[model samples]
Target chain A: MRCWERPLIEIIRLSVNGDSHEIGVPSHYTLLETLRYVLGLTGSKQGCDKGDCGACTVLLDGLPTLSCILPVQEAIGRQVTTIEGLADPDGPHALQDALDLTGGAQCGFCTPGILMSAAALLNVNSSPTRQEIREALSGNLCRCTGYTKIYEAVELAARALREQRPPAEVLRS
Target chain B: MLRLHPYEYHRPRELEAALELLKEHAGDVMPIAGGTDLVPNMKHRLFAPGHLVALKGLPELHGIVERQGEIVLGAAESLSSLADHHLVRSHLPSLARAAGAIAHPMIRNQATLGGNICLDTRCTYYNQTFFWREALGFCLKKDGDVCHVVRGGTRCVAAHSADTPPILMALGAKVDTASPEGVRSVELDEFFIADGIWNTQRKPDEIVTRLRVPLPSPGLRTSYQKLRERRSVDFPLLSLALAVGLDGDDRVESIALVVAALGAKPRRIGGLETLAKGERLHDELIEEIARQAYRQSNPLDNIIVDIEWRRAMVPVFVRRAIREALARP
Candidate 1:
C-alpha cells in the first residue's frame, strides 16, 4: 500500500481568510505544508519547525496560531489566515501601507508574521497605544527590520484609523 | 525534530464509545482532548500511541456549570475559557489567575484546563523526542530502566510540572472520572501520584469528566504566583498558590500553600500553615514563613533554569502569593 493509501488523508475543508482550501493533506503533514505546498498560499513562512518562532502565524478560528506547529488535521472546518488575507492586494490596509511606506519591509522574510500580528490588533482596536503595539508585536521577530520604523508604522496606522473614523452623528441622526 | 509515525484517527461523539475504543486498543490508543499538549508530543515521537482517539467530538467532556453551590468545570474547558468564566472568577479567582498566566493568549485559547492538569509528566532528560532518548538508551519514564535525573534512581524522576494543579488543590476542588468499571470522585490533592514512572494511579480506562470546586464563603481570598526564566510560554521553575481566610478580627482561619513544577506532585507545604493559623499576618511573620519554605524545597538539575534560582524564588513567590491573598490596607 502507498504511504497515503491506507484510507489515510482525512479530508480537511478549511475556510482560509476569505478563500477556501480543500486539500488531501497527509496524516503527518502540518497546516504550514497545506498553505505552502498544496494551495501555494506561502505567506505563512516556516521559520521554526517547532512552535517557538511566530513566522508561521495564522488565524485559526480568529486566533494567532503558529501553523508550523499546529497539525493540518486540526484545521478542519476552522478558519485560517495568512498575509494574503490582510487585505485585497490593490487595496492595502493602512497598517500594510504604513509598513511599506515606512520601509518596515527590509528583508521581508518576517514581515508576513509581523503584519498578521498587527492586523489582528487593528481588527480589534483601531487606535492602539505605542506600548500596545510593542506588546502585540512581541511574538513576531524581524531580524532585518530594526523595529524603529515598524513602531512608527504602527503609530501611523493608529493615526490613520483615528482620522478616518466614521461620523457618529451622521450614523445616529 | 523527529516525525510522528502515522496513526489512524477516530472521532467518537460519545464518551462510552471512546472508552470502548480505549478498551480495544489498550496501550496503543491515545485520547486527545485539546491537542495542545498531545499533538506536539506525538510530533516529537515522545510517546506514540498506535491509535489516535480524538475527543473533540465528545460534548459530555466539555462545558462549565454552577451546580448547587459548587462550580463544575468539564474536562474540555479551555484555559482561555476558564480565564474568562465569570463563575470561576467570582468563586475560584486564583484558578482564573493561574489559567490566564499560563503560556500566552493563543496557547490558552487551545490549551484546556484538563489538558494542563493532565499534562504529560516532564523533565529535561525525558522531554526529548524518541530518537534523542534512544541515543541516551532511554530513561525510566518511557523505554529505559534508570532515571537520568537522579543518575541511578530506580524510578522515573520526571516532574509533574503543571501550573494548574497547585491552584486547583488550593481551591479545594475534586474531580469526577468515568471508566468501564464505574465512576469515582478523586480529591484534587489525592489525584496526583508521588511516583514518576507511573505518575497518576488513575486507571487507563478512567477518563476525567468534571472538576468541581466548592462555592467560596465570605472572607475568602486567593492568589497565584509563578517563577519562570521569561514571562511568556515558559513553564514555571517554581510556582506557589495561596488561598486563605480571615475571621471577624482578621485572624487567619484557614490556609493552603501548594508548590508546583518542583517535584513529581504538587507538594503541599504543611509547615507553612503552622506559621499562618491564628496569627494576624505581618511582614516579619511572612518573611519567617518564606524562609522556612525556601529551605524545605529540594530542586534538582532535572529542569530548565538554575536549580539554585528555582530554590531561591520559593520564598519570594510564597511571600507574594500569601501577601496578595491577604492584601490588608
Candidate 2:
C-alpha cells in the first residue's frame, strides 16, 4: 500500500539480535507481530496474546519483556534479543543443549520464551539458586513437561555458563 | 491473534509536549507506560484510543529520590526497578513487596508504578474477549446497560485488582499529576472513586508524574498479604495492606488496614484507629479487629472466585496480615 493509502503506517528502525532493519508496520502492531510476521523471527511464540503468558518473551535491552503487549515503536531504539540470538556459529546455545539433555522441551512450544527468561536470569546471576530460577521463569507456563526438566535444564545451563564449558561436560560432572 | 486498532503513537521527550498531545487529543488519547494492562485491554476491545502518548523513560517522570522525609517515586519507574531499588526495599518494604508481587517477573520488568496505580478495574465479564462479552449481552461497565454481576444494580462493581494501591494508601502516599491545567497532588486515598467504569480521579488530560510516599516511622511495622490462586502472574483474589506503629510501651500508636480486590476502591477499614489506638496488639485485640474487617468487607460476585469463599478469606487474611505486621522487625 502507498503512504496515502494507509496513513497509520509507521516506519520503525528495529534493532533485533544485533541487526538493524527499517520496516514499515501498522502503528498499532506489537513487537511480537513485528518480529514473527515482519522480521520472520518466529522463535518467539505467541501464547496468550497478552501479558499473561511468557511465550512471546524477548529481551528488550537484555530484560525479559512481553513483546505481545509491547508496541513495536517502543522497541525502536532498544536492543531486541530473541531466541534466534541465543545460538552462535559453533552450535546451539548452552541453554538449548541443556534443555535437550534434560528433556525440557516436550512439546517445545514454550521453550523459546523459557530460554529467553532463563537467559536473562543467567546473564546476571551465573549461579542462581533453584528458587531464583523458579522466580525468574515464573511468567512462563509449560504444561507438557511439568517444569521439572525445564528447571533442571536451566541449572545445567547455568553450570555450563559458569564453568565456561559445553553443557555436556557440565552435565556429566 | 488479537491486535490493537491502528492508532497514532507519540513519543514526547518532555512532559509539556505529552500534555499538549493529551490536550489536543483529549478523550481520544491515552498515555501508555508499560502497555502491560492497556494493551491487553485494548485487545479485549475495552478501550480503543486514537492515539497513545508514550510515557516510558521520559526524564520528567523517571527516578526514585528521597527528599524531605519522603521518598518520591517517579511514576514511570518499572515495578522491578522499584522492587529491587535499595532505597525502596529499605525505606518502604511494604511498597516493595506490593510492587514485586504484581504479575510475574517479565510483566514486572515492563509494568510501571503509575500504571499499577492507575490500573483499570477488572471483572470476569468485562475482561473477556468481545465475543465472550457479546454472547452474554454485555454489561454496564462497558457497552451495555445491565450489570450481570448484580442484577438490577446500576453501578459498575468491577473490582480494583492492583497490588500497590492498598499499600500506597495505607502508607499515606501522594500522587502527583500534570496536565494542561498545571500540576496537582492528591492523597492516594482520595485518588480512587467507587465507580468502576473509571475509578481514578485522574482526568483525560492528566498524567501521573510521581508518587510521594512518606517515610515510615521508626516503630512502624508493615506487612502485605495477597490471596491469589497462584504464587505469581495472577491478580489478587483478595489483598490486605497492614501498617501498625507501636509506642514504647508496646501500645498501638497508629494503624491503617486497607483491603482491596473486592470493589472499585481499596477500602480502608473504618473505626480501626478507635479500636486499635492505645490498646495492646494482642491475640484478643487482633481477633476482634479481624472480625470487624470481615464484617466490613463485602466481596461482590464481580470476581470469578466464589463470593462466599472470598468473603470468608477476608478475616483469615486480616489475621495473617496483622500477625505478619507484628512479626516484622
Leading candidate by lDDT = 2
Q: Is the docking of candidate 2 incorrect, acceptable, medium or high quality?
A: medium
Candidate 1 has an fnat equal to 0.18
Which sections of candidate 2 miss by over 4 Å? A1-7
RMSD of 2: 1.7
Report the C-alpha lDDT of model 1 over A1-173, residue by residue, as the tens digit: 33323536766688887777676766666778778888888888888556555777888777777777666777787778788888776577777777877777888887888787787787788878887887677667777756888887777776776777322222233
Error of 2 at A167 (Å): 1.6
Worst 10 residues of 2 chain A by lDDT: A1-10
DockQ by candidate, in order = 0.30, 0.61
RMSD of each: 4.1, 1.7
**C-alpha lDDT score of every prediction, in listed order:** 0.77, 0.92
Model 1: per-residue Cα lDDT over B115-167, one tens digit each? 77788877887777777888999888778787877877886667777788898
TM-scores for every predicted model: 0.90, 0.98
